[model samples]
Target: MILCADIGGSFIDFAVVHPDGRTEHRRSVPTPLDNAPAFIGALVALCAPWPDMPLHIAIAGVECPDTGIIHAANIPCLQALPLAAHLHRETGRAVRIANDADCFALAEAHFGIAKGHRNVFGVILGTGIGGGFVLDGRIVPGLGGVTGEWGHAPVVIPPPVPLDQEAAETLVPLFRCGCGISGCLDTIAGARALERLHLWAGGTPQTSRAIFEAWQTGDRQAGRTLDIWLSYMGAGLAHVINVTGSTIVPVAGGLSNAHALVDALDEAVRARILTTTSGPLLRRAALGADAGLLGAACLGLDIRAQE
Candidate 1:
């Protein structure tokens, strides 16, 4: 069995996962963001009863493959820390870590919607955009452990032609991103970004869910906001699809719950991409919240296989 932990900014979901992918003894605990020792202590305490078992982690951050240093923006204490090594030393057991998005992708590829696909991209459209790429049933190793982070790149530049009235009226700004970049798709995509984009398009302040609901109900204001959203989101995804040659794109996170919205995105992406298949390219995530922990288990299983 592998001890798996899905560490997020706010909580840590812990479980014991069997080799066949069944999980047990699952628990959730509030994360200690400000204290590194507390973070390690939390993991140690969670897995203490199952001594000698390997621990695997899916974290909401990047771990540099070369240096083992973590870059977790949400959990400040983990920044620059060698989290896997620290945990292993503290718990006296082997430990492994991967970005949560990558873990989600790996889980999808192995056990979820992208099963049997050689190339897959699992995208998370939540508070902000994130993704992970899987090739040949394995997560691709990345420089600075930052593969499949397509959300941060600046893809939307203002068109040169005279803008339509809605476009002119919206005047979407090149909002700065947490990654220290401007004009990034992240600034305009995802949940909070969607709300921001909605307001920019002259709509009243509302949650992304409300906006999606309004759009579904044929509200003109929400419809216009979503139109702008689909345009940029679809174009960005099309570029990713073309470049990755991924046969399937499994989407997770809050936005993925909007089936119609995902369907609309699929339509937009299909219309823009070079591929001409009649089937839908984007699929809803099968694993949902369990994806991260499952992927962490999968990561441990993969490492054990290599040994």
Candidate 2:
């Protein structure tokens, strides 16, 4: 069994995972975000019961492969700390850590919808956009341990000229992203960003769900917002697909719940991609919430394989 923890800003989800992806002794605790020692202690106590097993963590942050420094914006205590190394010293157990999104991709490649695919790109379309790339069933490490961060770059293109109109009816502004970049896909593609886009497109402020629902009911204003969304989002994903050559994309997050929206986005992406495929490339992730823990297990399993 591997002691696996999915550490997010809100909670630390702990589980003992079998080699085949089954989890036991599952539990969760509120994460100690402000205090470093408390954060370390929480994990230590969780793993104490299984002293012989190694600990694998999937964190909501990036760990620098070169310096072992973890950069988690939400969990302030872990910033700049060599988390895995510190935990190994304190607990006397082998420790492995990876970005949560990377873990998600690894898990999906190993056991979920992308199981048979050698190249998988897992995307999270939640409050913010994030992604991870897995090649040949292993997480592809990058410089600064920041692989698959497709959302941060300036990729939004000028709105396409309308075919039958004298001028374009909608114009998408290059809103500044939290990453400090203008024209990033993240500014208009995430769930919250979708709401912002709805308002910017002359609709009253509404939740992403409400907007999608309104669009489904043929509300013209809502439809306009979603059209803009699909255009930029599809273009961004197509650029990613072209660059990565990923055979499949497993999508997870709040937006993935809307089957119709995912279908629409999938169709839009297919239309934009350079290469043709017999079927859709994007599929809703299969593992749901268990992806993080299961992914952490994959990390531990990799260590054992190396041994």
lDDT of each: 0.91, 0.91
Give one digit per residue, the lDDT tens place, for model 1 in 1-307: 8899999999999999987779999999999999998998899999999998888999999998888999998999988799888887777898889999999999999889999999899899999999999998889988878999889877755667988887765566778888888878898899999999999888999999999999999999999999989999899999999998999999999899999999999999999999897699899999989999999999988998899
- Alpha carbon deviation, residue 293, candidate 1 (Å): 0.5
Instruction: Go through the candidates in order and give the clash count of each.
Output: 0, 0
Please give the lDDT score at residue 85 for candidate 2: 94
Best by TM-score: 2
TM-score of each: 0.94, 0.95
Give the poorly placed runs of model 1, Cα more than 4 Å off: 158-171
lDDT tens digits, residues 1-307, model 2?
Answer: 8899999999999999998999999999999999999999999999999887789999999999998999999999987899989999998888999999999999999889999998899999999999999998889999889999989998765666544443444457678999888889899989999999898889997999999999999999999999999988898899889998999999999999999988898899999999999998999999999999999999888887778
lDDT of 1 at 133: 92
